[model samples]
Target: GYKGDQIRDFFLTYGDQGRDVTVNLASGGSPQWYGDPQTEDWEVTLVETGTGARIKRVAAYLDQPYFLQTYGDGIGNVDIGALYTQHVASGLVSTVTGVHPTSRFGEMHVSGERVTEFNEKPTMADGWVSGGFFAHKREMVDRYLDDDPDLLLEKKPMQTLASDGELGVFTHEGFWMGMDTFRDWTELNGLWDSGDAAWKVWA
Candidate 1:
């Protein structure tokens, strides 16, 4: 079974502070980028579940040019920016910002041609991009979930979506962390006890 509360918490943590965000859960493989190639846009971030570290800025975009698959090992093998570039070069996608990786977190960043400047570091100043939290629009769900049963909605889907510009990012300006192992869980609990969880929402 899925951790409904955890899902709820995750969505609430990323949802707009005062707006209503609907989270739909379906039994499947993963979620994919679904939106108009011309209008939708988004960004990607690497979140380490064990250490709760938002390693780097990954990618950004607004179409379904590529798809990444997650095997049994749990790690995703996404080319990050290759798909978008191919699409843009081939004219399948509009002329948008190119994709690049960051230094601190080793994540990728994608921007449109209109995106004049780029930030190297993640901070509360940049809507907490380094924190790995995001604020997505309702349309993200509507397009991504277009009655796809096999869609798992996992990390790969997110990566592909962000890379394709189907999702937008609303970085949070607080503590954030991901728990992927027993050690990480313990450490996160300790941080919570000491009042230092970056992703703490109910505190």
Candidate 2:
């Protein structure tokens, strides 16, 4: 999934060292590695899965009772410490970050042809979408994950969790963005330049 020392370097920048980071990536059949990086404390291992391996492959390397899995490109200002606490308290197999996606267009409430209320790029309050930040218990992964290589983490597994009343959600009303396109990259850069990034949780 992830290549090179970028992850290691990132954590080093934040003064976190000697961390074991496991990344699961399934391109076509499984993950393929590129090379090795020489680092002191940080170590990132790449695990290969099929296109549908989803997050199940991570169960193999999940050392802790609880592990956090976040998309490399997704950024948010979620209180992860609090999320961990909630997951433990709820005793669910999994807990994921729930975010209200911002509307691409402005919203207008009209009353008798009069613009009563207008909100520009407002956050949607109807349904929440998963922000790709996940916390999972070993048992959850062990019980749900299979080697089929066609399973989707967000599909049947998640649905089963919901059906079994085992899914927990930590709602975040703050900003959440994924750097998927050039426009997204530019927007994040703009926020960085303007010092107005809502996802900046660090000092």
Candidate 3:
């Protein structure tokens, strides 16, 4: 939703309050942590890189053996700890969170030209898709991912990983939705306003 530097600036202000904030404007940018370290429940870091940089370039800053990645547009009640545990148990280079996506069109059941039942935007009964909550070992970047700035994560890297049998999947049957449209934005806001947001797993 936020364009240009709006998202970065918002987080910078939010993190700068009652805490120190530092930003690096160089290549291979450093970790820009937000919020107070002692009291904050989670850590937020904004890593700056060149425009049109590849995902692997940004990932080069990752110092940990394992890390998570996801698109900002999707929200869900995915269990992060469980995902990490599954990744470890599977011993794969990466683990992708798969979800049954809701259909864009309404479903209708008919018998002899008589409308029997109808469901609006129902969740599909078959097939799971990547919901973007990815848990990856550092080896994935070292092996599968490339240094090309034009490389897309969903393209060659994922394809190669699956072909190599190193990509595991963690299926999450709970609430998940992607905010790619205005309708989705309104629906998510309505849920939050009505206090019925299923993705709000925290107190």
Candidate 4:
């Protein structure tokens, strides 16, 4: 509910794009939408829940076998259908998109106190981190998550799922970036402006 008002106003203005929206609030009240919502087929429900409680709260309103989850700060061209296919094929409760992020500083390969190779801020070649894209079975909500206000999906929940052999990873070797800081924001905007944003796979 950090930007509850702004989010509500945005959906109220342009949420009729074939899908319904439900804005969960941490505060305990549902405010009315002004004017007509412009759609008879779509429904919008504004309710009370925070990040920690979002998965459980949202799952309560859903009747599907699979649910998608991701952080709002990251953008990527991850193939959702492929991810879901992998998740189901693995018979896992959760599948997270793993990405190789770029290193922030210059990289140097040294041999006996001598620099053998150097690359400036190269993409990490050895490890993958969560790109924040996720595909999950609805069972994951009840089985791996909880209602505690401090329950983080990336923490105990994911760890427990991994320990239980219910977690899978989809390796995404495409463009992915996280807008966590001002520099990242600027860089992403620059990519868009230059028409070099690899994540723009749709028209």
Q: Top TM-score: which candidate number?
A: 3
TM-score, predicted candidate 3 vs. hidden true structure: 0.82
Tens digits of per-residue lDDT for model 4 on 1-203? Answer: 56767777777766454445555587756654444445446666655576566778777676889877777789899998999889888888999999999887899999999999999978897999999988998898888777888888888999998999888999999888888899899989999999999889876
Model 3 Cα lDDT, one tens digit per residue, 1-203: 23637767866665456666577767657757766643455666666544333457767578889988878899899999999999988989999999999998999999999989999999886999999999999888878876676767888889999999989999999989999999999989999999989999887
Cα lDDT tens digits, model 2, 1-203, are 45435654665444333334444655445433344543556456555543666467656677778887787778889889988899889889999999888787899999997999999878889999998888888888778778787777888888999999999999988889878889779989999999999888865
**Candidate 3 local Cα displacement, residue 64, angstroms:** 1.1
Clash-forming residue pairs, model 4: none
Candidate 3 pairs with clashing backbones: none
Each candidate's number of clashing pairs is: 26, 2, 0, 0
TM-score of 4: 0.80
- In TM-score terms, candidate 2 sits at 0.74
Runs of candidate 4 with Cα error greater than 4 angstroms are 15-48, 111-116
The lDDT per prediction is 0.38, 0.78, 0.83, 0.83
3 against 4, candidate with superior TM-score: 3
